[model samples]
Target: MSKPIFERDPSDPERQKINPALKLLLELGPLLVFFFGNARGEWIAERLPALAGIGGPIFIATALFMVATVIALAVSWALTRSLPIMPLVSGIVVLVFGALTLWLQDELFIKLKPTIINSIFGLLLLGGLLIFRVSLLRYVFDSAFNIDEEGWNKLTVRWGAYFLVMAVVNEIIWRNFSTDFWVAFKVWGFTPLAIAFTMAQMPLISRHSLDEEPAE
Candidate 1:
């Protein structure tokens, strides 16, 4: 029997058909906006004094950051129809936390938002494997590369732990560091760390790769 049209299967022919450059753009655009909004907060506030009452650069940045996130998600939906799973999760948290930060006029909420989201993701991914006997990693990565169930479990576990580490790191940085420093870490530090960690898993990925198989 054929798979449902909207269901994502690791072996789907169409899953492998995304435009690599566009995919990268979709992934990176909102992050760029976040960094830009944070970095340019003062300039933006100067041009629009109303933003000054928003508390500080970080607050202004958070507001614009939310706007940028919405735009990014909209673009993703326009391009892909379905939302990208990971970013969709993160975007929802952004909207929620960003709103709280704005409404409460507390930067702490915004600062802690990443920590909460990462912790939730870490626990969810890890708990999914433990309880359901399946790794959710396949949904995000199945299109790019195929892996055996064991490989999926291992990747999921590693990513889960990685998310926890990110949560801890975000907590440490935001609680103790300057807003500029945290924003820099948020934009620059995390992505490279994730990329490096992914590279470290190359052996496991190669071992289980179904790259050459015909779509099921």
Candidate 2:
């Protein structure tokens, strides 16, 4: 029996692979837009004046972020005919929270969006591991990497921990910091932290990697 199309590994021979750069862009594009938009929203609103209706810098940025997220998801779906699970989940949160932020003219909604997303993901991953005896990461990212069962379990645990930690960090930063600081951290700080953490997992990934194994 074959894996379902949705479960096909990203490295699977038959999948219509995206350019690696494009894939990265799709994943990070909306975030970059959000950060840039927030950082420059005042300047943007000043020139465009029409955007003044959006309320403030953070609100304008949230609006742009939502638009970018939608476009990214649409592009991914058009190319692959299936949305990647994690991005889809995140994008949905962005849209929902971003909308509330705009409609209410409140920045807290957008600020809390990351905290909520991370909490949900952490809980789901941990629940799947402890209660269901499964690595929930597989459901969201089976196609992104290949690992042995033990490696998958370890990787899932680490990611679950990381997600929860990130949730707490987001809460702390947003609650204590200025909006500009939060925006900067969201883009410049969190992105590098995530990248570094991913790099730190290279040993685990290589150790459990399926790519080098002989096919049956």
Candidate 3:
């Protein structure tokens, strides 16, 4: 079998681990790029006519969003030699939805991308837990923790529900708000909310930790 993506070298005392700080940058970097691209899209188009193909703020933003996401994913693959699951999934969605947005010249498609992605995750996590009788969350968090089966199950359920909640919130915001406001919320609002929720789970994580050494 192939080596696990998150596995650490056993004998390399000087080896570097993927720090949370860098992970945050890797994850949030593309969104920041997208916001900047959209906010400055007019100046960009005025300076570079080539970018005028995807004219207007939203279209230019969508195109640049795709580019930024692809760059982020490529950097992650280069650094780790393995794709992180969530980013991979999100990148794929960005490409597909962003393409449609550019092709159709409609901003709604890009605006609704997050709602669809989050809903799919909610279903996948919740349904997999029910059908497999095991928490699919383990695949992502296993590198960070050694929780028992029951703890894994509880965490998985919580995450699955959280995904659903996020989807609903995205739908409400994007549907009722202006595109620029939605874009700002997508970058600035959603991430902090997720971090807050994850932080709230730390006590539970510590309680369920297996008291084993982290792989390194």
Candidate 4:
């Protein structure tokens, strides 16, 4: 029988250790909550008066997003006994930006969250590869894939460039688009882009598969 995700041995580096559906929920639950909260913040505030201080719909959503992120991290810690680095970093970003958005009553901070996070990821990946000669992608995805050194290097370069593009795209959308459209795009558009990008990497991944003969 497959080991339950929470019970998987830390020493094992395998994909789908956790149920994929549950993993997706834990990773994305907060974002889904944030989107819902933004769409219904006033309704929620009216029903629960304590949240009136949260200001606008987006602000209320940001506050809830912070709470949800904290919960997700807590649950991850409880289950894994160790924090996942990328999620931890992203969670920290959300809290800091979420707090600023609430304290300043300016939505710009929350709006810039994706841009900042994506840019940091992009720079870290590219800088690690180009300047430090390190492939940070391995740390993030080692469990899911095993690649040759050359493959890792190429994949790292590709992902780094993609992340930079995503960051610029976020900036453009938030700066010029409607808030509703931006929020929806964050949920729908960017996610599809990321999924597509990941899928697109399969050719390179399969070529470098440790378990299979390297493609000629």
What Cα-based lDDT does every candidate model obtain?
0.81, 0.85, 0.81, 0.84
Colliding pairs, model 1:
none
Off by over 4 Å in 4: 1-21, 212-216
Q: Against the true structure, what is each candidate's TM-score?
A: 0.86, 0.87, 0.85, 0.86
Question: How displaced is residue 192 in candidate 3, in Å?
Answer: 0.9
Q: Which stretches of candidate 1 lie over 4 Å from their true place?
A: 1-17, 48-53, 213-216
lDDT of 2 by residue, 157-201 (tens): 989999999999999999999999999999898889988988898
By lDDT, who's the top model here? 2
Candidates' RMSD to native: 3.9, 3.6, 4.4, 5.0
User: What lDDT is obtained when candidate 1 is compared to the true structure?
Assistant: 0.81
Across residues 56-102, which tens digit of lDDT does each residue of candidate 4 receive?
Answer: 88998999999999999888767666566667888999999999999
Positional deviation of residue 30's Cα in model 4 after best superposition, in angstroms: 1.4
C-alpha lDDT (0 to 100) for residue 190 of candidate 2: 86
Error of 4 at 58 (Å): 0.2
For model 4, what is the alpha-carbon lDDT of residue 136? 77
In candidate 4, where is summed lDDT lowest over 10 consecutive residues? Answer: 2-11
Candidate 3 ranges with C-alpha deviation above 4 Å: 1-17, 212-216
lDDT of 4 at 102: 95
